[model samples]
Target chain A: MVERALLLCLLLIGFWGVVAKKNIIKKIFGLNILNAAAVMLFILEGNRIGSEAPILESGLAQVVDPIPQALMLTAIVIGVCVTALALALAVHLYQITGSFDIETIRERIQDET
Target chain B: MGKRKAWSPTLQACLAIGAMGVVLLPVFLSQTPWPTVARDYLMQYGQDESGARNLVSAIYLGYRAFDTLGETIVLLVAVIGTMGLLSRVESLVNTVGDDDNTIQTVSAFSLRGDKRSSHVLRTHLLEVVTGKIGPIVLLFGFYVMLYGHLSPGGGFQGGVIIASGIVFLALGNQQDNTSALSKSSILGGIESVSFLLFIIVAMSGIFFGKGFFGNPLADSAYPVGFIVLLNSIIGLKVGASIGFMCIAMMGGHD
Candidate 1:
């Protein structure tokens, strides 16, 4: 229950970051935090009673679910890719506009028109 | 200062909070547990069937190889997109030269101001340390990749490790002279070849009478070899692709 609450709190914080922040970099970081929270939630859900690592060891009875871990591994890599792409786009945006502030960029665009 | 707001910040925050609450309500209320049928089957026969003692490896390389292939493609697409975008800026800078001051300022920011004096003792120490540790980190990455089936680490982890080592080397080297280590073309070549090899191996399984990406060696006593091969290929592909991406992205900055 505590873990679930913590995960939810993290998700909410990330949501706040994404919604409230104007800086593009902060938005990217919020996206990352959101990804991390989801990954952790999946891993946490896979935890079982008397569960052990999925490695085949002698006389081991219960092993935690490996499927989630495998899927989450893919998710983590995809997250990295997304972060990289977003940062590259941010760099391009920064190049076009002198500032990272979204409002400033918007005003600059309007003035140009 | 009196611009009309699309929606008040409080209203947006309340909407966000409400949406989050609605989304999480079901998860908090019900405890529909994960089905154990697949997990049980995997735990029982995973080793004998997939020849990987680590069940996660079996799932990743054997049962779900198709998913892994798709994931690699996703990574490839992302790298290509980033490089394409960055290359446009490079060409723009090259064509414009110093005519536009704004472009000059943009390029300067993008370059990250690595204009440090080379004779600085602190810079020399950093260079020496990164130069020494780089090879060791790379070797360790290979070890993790090769031993993935038996250990916790896998191609993705090892590949990231290797890329970080390359990044360290790239960062330590002076900006004016390109480092011997930062060969983007060579890294790109390795990435393409390894991805092709991975696909070829996957296709070979189909031709060998095993289903697509099926373990042809499952009939043999040591089916782990196939998993190991896939792991190595994945490691090389990921490491090269990430390393190339890093080099390409930083290439402009330097």
Candidate 2:
């Protein structure tokens, strides 16, 4: 129960950080936090009520749903890629301009307009 | 006046908290018990089909290996894109003179100004946290990836953990050189090796005359070990790909 709540908090914090932060780099940090929290939540959710065995089982028994765990794995990899791409864009944006702040970048872009 | 000015921050805080409460409510409220039907279906059919007791591995390596492959490709594309967009080769050459100027500014400014005190304070705090907490997180990530076959984590989960650790390193040490540790060649090599290993493992069944990506000799004693091996391979691919992608983007930047 406590673990679940912690995971929930992580999810929320990550979301909050991404949405609220203005600095592009800080926004990336929030996205990472959010991704980490979501991945942790999926792993924790896959936990058997009392058994430590992964969703894998060899014999005739009810194992945990490995599907979500598997899906989450893909999700984690994709998340990392997305974050990297976003950060790379941020760096490029920084280079073309000279600031990590999103508002400044936006204004500089607008000025070109 | 101070209190009056606090409302903006307070309002921001309130909106943040409220948004969180709303996002979390549905996830918490809608709970479903693990279905007994799934448990039985997997136990009976998965062992015979995948020839592994661990149903999760069967699903991971067998059922959804395609998804894994797609994710790996996503990472590969990300690195390539980052390299194209953010490679420091041009910047390094073009800004060599500017780099020296900034370095001089940083060093000189540090020595004789009030900024030095704050810089020293920040450096000390960074050293303290990165030195202490960083290794623990890295180790935990390794354990998560390694023991994924037996626990809740697998290659994907563990890979992200490891990538996060690398990100932590980048965060603490903003020096461009620190990021170079995850070089393109090194990361590219690890990513390819692991990916190839996965293909070989999956094709083992085809070579052995079983079904496609199926293990004929899986039942006696070695199938379990093979599954575990494949899990580790997947972990390596996912972890290295993610680590490489993250490092490439940041490391190659000016």
**Could you tell me how far off, in angstroms, the CA of residue B189 lies in candidate 1 after the best superposition?**
0.6
Chain B TM-scores of the candidates: 0.81, 0.63
* Candidate topping lDDT: 1
lDDT of 1 by residue, B152-218 (tens): 8888888888887876676555444555556777778888999999998888788769978988787
> Comparing only chain A of model 2 with the true chain A, what is the TM-score?
0.82
Off by over 4 Å in 1: B1-6, B91-125, B174-180, B252-254
The number of the candidate with the highest DockQ is 1
TM-score result, candidate 1: 0.88
Error of 2 at A55 (Å): 7.3
Whole-model alpha-carbon lDDT for candidate 1: 0.79
**TM-score of each model, in listed order:** 0.88, 0.65
Provide per-model DockQ scores. 0.59, 0.45
Docking class of 1: medium
